[model samples]
Target: MRIQRIQAIAISLPLIKPVKMSFEEVRNAENVLARIETDNGITGWGEAASAPTMTGETQGSMVAAIRHLADKLEGLPADDIPAAMHRAGQYLYGNNSAKAAIEMALFDALGQARGKPVYELLGGAKRMRVPALRLIGTGSTAGDIAETQKRLAEGYVAIKIKVGVDTPEADAERARAVAASVKDDKVLICTDANQGWTPDEAIRFVKGIADTRIEFFEQPVAAHDVAGMARVAAASRVKIGVDEGLHSLDDLRHHHQLKAALGASLKTIKLGGLQAVHDAALLCEELVMKVNLACKIAEAGIASAGLMHLAAAIPSVDWGVSLSSPYLADDIVAEPIALSGGYINVPTGPGLGIRVDETKVRRYTREV
Candidate 1:
């Protein structure tokens, strides 16, 4: 079916509870939603929550780019996604969020037309349920320990604590407290510095907690510091996971060549879309490295659904998913996607399987 219309909506939904990480505190989620309508009356939805400094696209830019590309997309076949994307890219510079939003919607449309979930289209499901880890944000040692215990009591076996907010000593103390909170060593604990530390400091801080069981360290130094990351990875006791640094297939390959990281945190927005994420997963497998289907601190929408399907299909995602849970006060969908025992069940319906509640979405929409 040929594309008929492309629409973009910006929504700001309040979080049930503010999530504080190493870098910043997030209250409401600002997400740009894209919807594509085919001449055959098929509609598909996508989400692209941009971090302008990271992906170089803001919500306003994403909307404008999609609107400007509407003419080119109007007559294109929905199934010619790669070609359509290439055409769109030729016209624009770098609004990856805009590109991802359109691409995901097209994939959703293709899945619906084929009478299959998106995962079925991208290979097939390798696992029924994907385990998830609760990310504990930055706080004092006592507060951090309390939060860890609370999440553990809520049946979350794995926890990722935010560090690098303060000095190395303060961050180390927070990490140590979190590690000591859980009695079981099997309860996996990891720390994300959010590229807050220098290479030397990362090594020192990670080594200080050598006795504690930290599964891995994430983005120890700045995103572009490949050589520094390699040095830290070599010297640190904990395994290294590159997050902000590796955004694309080339970035992943570059990190692999430099031996900069042992694992990668693949964010859909960062990589652009589901296709990009799948490509990254295959590349990770080829390199014999682990990948984690991660999320930005946003409400559950198309992005969450896409990652859920992607994580279920990839067997190498051993580190579990760090997906944004549907625990937000306002989710765009009618029924909250279920999470049981710290794992989310893959949707089995056609397309994304999770239906979008148009009324709810409109209520939160900032623009028509």
Candidate 2:
């Protein structure tokens, strides 16, 4: 089927609670959706969260970018995702979040036409289920430790502690307390600073937590300073990871060459789309870096479903997957992807597998 039409819809969805990061507090999910229709009357949907701190794309900018790209993509072959994406890159540059939305919709449509799951389109599934990483940041040490215990009791195999808000020593104490609460040695404990600290501060934090079982520390310094990341990594006994620093395969290679990070947190919004994430995962395997697949702080079921497929098809997920739908008060899919015993199963049906509820989409939709 040939491409027919494309439209961008902006929405604001409430989060269950505010997620406090170093740079900002997320009270609601501001996202953009791409709806594509083929000449044969089949429709596909894709989504991207507006992460201004991470991707430099707000909801308004993403909507405008998609509208500009839609004109360049219409009449192109719907199944030729790569070619269409190349065309989009030629016309627009560095709007990965907007392009991710368009690319996801194309994959959904192609999978439906081929009678296969999206994972199959991404080179088939290496595994059917992945452990879901829970986030624990209740704004206090006592509250964070309590939440960590609750997550462990609920069977979460991985958990991430939000730090970088307080002094390095204080955050280190909280990380220690939370790590001590998890009796299971196999449970993965990680932390993300979201580029909230100076290299010296991050070094101090890692040194303070030297006695703990924390697996890795992520994006401690700024995204632009690879040298700062390297300095922190050298001072850190715990493995270091990159989140904001990684935008392309070249970035990955640069980090590896500089010994800046031992692993990375992969997000579609950062890399552009599913295909780009897959390529990054392969490169990580070659470099022997651990992989952590994640959706942004708050995405709905469409983006979460896309994450599940990538989790299933990626070579490895040593750091686990962070699916964001669970953080939302409600989702736009008819059947949201629910976590069971702290794990998620990949959707096995055609296209994205979950049905989009147009009614709910409209309810959440807002003018950009």
Candidate 3:
């Protein structure tokens, strides 16, 4: 019933292909995994895939924060997740990822103890299959066009193309090429700028693509520029979805007031953990804003399960999920979480349905 120990592991898992977004390119996923042990001998697993560019915490800082909070969590009841999050936040400033990691472990422990999946514990599932979207990296125009065609052929109806890595004209040309290559009018095309454009530039770039069938544009301007976001959203013909900007509930409220974003891209790690993400989803519903579940460039184990549960519970996730493909990793869970017909089946077991291969985790664990 009470916490006994908190163990943190830092692993660097190589990606099958280097993932490039407008803001950064990554070859390996560095994630901080935590396991919390209870006095009754139950162990719960969690992961913090912090984005130093986004959350201001790297793998090292997140692990240290988890270890620092070990004493405070030792005697606390694992079921009191809200209380734990409050205590962690009150004592440590800007450690959302660390708090999220621990909070996830607590939820996992409670779910396992009660013999229920995490989604049922949060709220019952709303759908059996969650729709997903594929991300096309910043490859050559010809290569990216081919990739988009390939993904469409593979049953991915929705595709998000990475832009903002080059000149506005160049990015627009690439997007136009991909849009043209797919040749499916029903396919949803979205562009992620990854906070790479200036407000004026974003307005111009998005305006150029306004005539196309693109569904929405994500994080075009800098993450902190709410005013710029408002300006761009107000001027652009396409709807805007904010990702890095709406990291917290307060941030969501601010964007709502500004009318800066028509949709929100919520990620498990960015909100700190699942509970925070759940709170955000509920808030978005209350505000009548569309929600989109996004992913960190983390391992498949926690990210895949967390996103599946999130997309299943939310009512208005119109843009689908932007999770990294688990199939893109050389080493991951024992059974691959495959995509079928552009959707993923929600897991139906205790806690997170997928089991983690501890041996594989150990093999990738880095010595500190």
Candidate 4:
């Protein structure tokens, strides 16, 4: 099947509740929706949730890149996703969210055409369901502890604590508080600093929480300060992981060469889309390192479904993924993701396996 048309939809959907993170407070999901229609009359949907503080892209820039990329992808064969995406990279640089949206739509179309899920296209599903990580907000100690307690009760194997918004002492206290409350032997507690700390501050915080039994620390220093990250990894009480600091496979390779981090969290948008994420995860496995599948802060079903497929196929993703399903106000799909006991089942049908609702799309979509 050949690509016939591409449409970019900009949507701002309110969160179920505002989530204050280490970097910024997110009140809603600012996302760009990519709609691709093939000549064979197959339609596929994808979402790119723009996080200015994280991915450094905005809704306006994402939409612009989407339009330009759609025009560039107008006449390509749907199956040649890599080629299309590579051309898009040449057309525009660093609009990963836009490129990811376009690539996802192409994958959706390809999967639907082959009568398989997107994961099957990348690699066959390794499991039916994958466990998820509960990311607590950067709120008060009591509130954060309560949420952590609740998720632990829900049988989550992992939890992510948000830190670095306060003093190193305060952040260490917060981490210790959650660690003290979580008594599950199976639960692995982690922290995402969102690059909120300097190298020295990161060291101080990690040293302070050395007794908290943290499984890993994510993106402690600035995103580009790999040298600083290396310093933290060498001295940290726990493993040092990174998310925002590593974007593409090249970035992953660089980190490996430097041994900059213990592990990494790969998002579809950060890697250009489905294929790239799978490739990166496999590379991490070969390097004998942990990989985490993570989605944007607040996601619509399209993005979440895409994430589920990737998580399902990657057996190397041992730590568990962080998803925003429970935090979104509503989803654009008719059937939301299935979550039971902190485990998410990958979609079973063709393509992304979630039916997009035009009604919700129209309801949530707005001009940026």
Candidate 5:
């Protein structure tokens, strides 16, 4: 089958609560959704949440790239999704989020045509369910503690507490509250400084909480500072995980050589798309390291489903994945992803497995 049409939309879905990282606070999910239609009448859906700070992409760029590529994708054969990605790459440069959105749709189409789930398309799935870890913002310590307790009560066992937005002492206290709260439970806490701390500050904060159960430190230093990351990793007892730092294969190689981190957080938009994500996970495995397959926050069902399939197929993504769509005020899918006992059941149906709620998507669609 060949491509017939590609439709794209930009949606601004409000968050249940604003998510504040060290750099920006977002109240709504600025996401782009895409649907690819084949000549045989089968269609597949995809979504993207771009981050200028992380993926160096904005919603406008994603929409523009999708519109530009639609003309070129009209006749590409859908039997080989990787070839579709390569052809899409030829029409756009550096619009990974845009390309990722299209790749997701292509994979969805391929899965449906083959009567297999996207995970099965990647490789036979290793798991049928994946766990989600709720993230705590850098707003209030007491609030953060209460939120952690609330999520735990709702069956979440892992929480990522934001650090580095405050002073070293204050960040320690913020993390301590959540770590201490889970001390008696079978839960683990992770600290994500979002590259908000200096190497010295990261060392100090981790040392201060050295007695707590904080499992790992994520992006403690700046994204571009691999040397600082190495220094912080060397100085801290808690293992470090890189997020924004691993933007390219060379970046991964550099960090691996320095032994800067034990694991990395991979996102579809930042690395290009599923093909690139698969490559990165393999590289991590080559180094005997783990990877946390995560999505941009507030992604709609299409993006979430893509991540679930990827996490299911990749062995090194043993680190639990996060599905933040459930935390949104609303989702643009007929069947929202279900998270129970900290685990989300992967969709077993063909394509992304979740169906888009087009009416809701239209209501949430933002002006281009």
Candidate 6:
């Protein structure tokens, strides 16, 4: 099948509740959706959340990027995803979030045409069902502890406590209380500072949590501060994982070299697309670094499904998979991807394995 048309739709979907992180509080999910039509009349969909703090792409920016690339990619063969993406890269630099949306649409269209799932196109499923990593940041120590207990009761195998919003000592106290709430010793516990701390502050936080069962700490300092990251990593017994700091395979290598982080939170918004994330995961495996596959703070079902496919095919989800569709009050899919007892089963159907609800999409659509 050949590409016929591509249109970018911008939407603002309501979140179930605001998610508090170190950088910003997310009240609503502002995202851009790419609708790609093949000559054979197959319609495929893709989405990306506008994460200015992470990818420097807003809803308007992603929409414009998709519009800029649409005509350039319109005549390319639908099945030749790599060629199409390479052409896009030649015409544009950065804009990984926008590229990810378009690349996801191409994969969906190709998978539909070939009657295969997106995971198969990547490689093959290493595992069918993946553990869902729950975020426990209710903005209070008691709230966090209660939330952690609730999530643990719901069967979440992994949990990430949000820190860096307050004093490192205060956040550490909250994390300890939260971690103590989880009675199951098998549960994975981690923390993400989201690049919100100084090296010394992060080191202090890790020191406070030294006796806690928190598995790893993520993005403790600024994204560009590899030296700061290295210092924090050295000061703490907890393994550091990079999030905002990682944008390419080279970033992974650099972090590995400096001992900045022992794991990374892989996101399409950071890496560009599924292929890029898959390649990064392969590299992580080779380096023996842990992997945390995730969507941005709030993405709809399309991006969430894309994550599921990646989660299915990636070599290891040692840090667990974080899906954001569950945070949305409404999703643009007929059946949204949700955690069943805190675990998400990968979509097994052709393409993205979810039906796009055009009506819902239109309802949520906003002028960009």
lDDT of 1 by residue, 1-368 (tens): 98888888888788877877656777877788889998888899888775665576776887888888888788898988888988987888667777888888898888888899998988999987877778887367887888888878777778888888888777888898889879987787899988888898888888877888988889989899999999998888788999989777899988889999988998878887788888899988989888888767784667788778888777567777887745478788766667787777887777887788899888888862
Clashing pairs in 3: none
**Tens-digit lDDT track for model 6 on 298-330?**
899999999999999999999989999888899
**Taking the tens digit of each residue's C-alpha lDDT, what string does model 4 give over 139-246?**
888999999888878878889988888998998998899899987767888998999999999999989988877889999988899989988887887988889888
- How much is the lDDT of residue 5 in candidate 4? 96
Off by over 4 Å in 4: none
The TM-score of candidate 1 is 0.96
Q: What TM-score, computed on C-alpha atoms, does each candidate reach?
A: 0.96, 0.99, 0.96, 0.98, 0.96, 0.99
Using lDDT, give the best candidate's number: 2
* All candidates in order of TM-score, best leading: 2, 6, 4, 5, 3, 1
Pull out the clashing pairs in model 1: none
Which sections of candidate 3 miss by over 4 Å? 325-327
What is the lDDT, from 0 to 100, of the residue 97 in candidate 2? 97
Q: Of models 5 and 6, which has the larger TM-score?
A: 6
User: Total clashes, candidate 4?
Assistant: 0
RMSD of every candidate to native, in Å, equals 1.6, 0.6, 1.5, 1.1, 1.4, 0.7
TM-score of 5: 0.96
Encode model 2's per-residue lDDT on 188-251: one tens digit a residue.
9999999999999999999999989999999999999999999999999999999999999999
Tell me which residue pairs clash in candidate 6: none
Candidate 2 wrong stretches, greater than 4 Å = none
The C-alpha stretches of model 6 lying farther than 4 A from their native spots are none
User: Where's the lowest-lDDT run of ten residues in candidate 1?
Assistant: 50-59
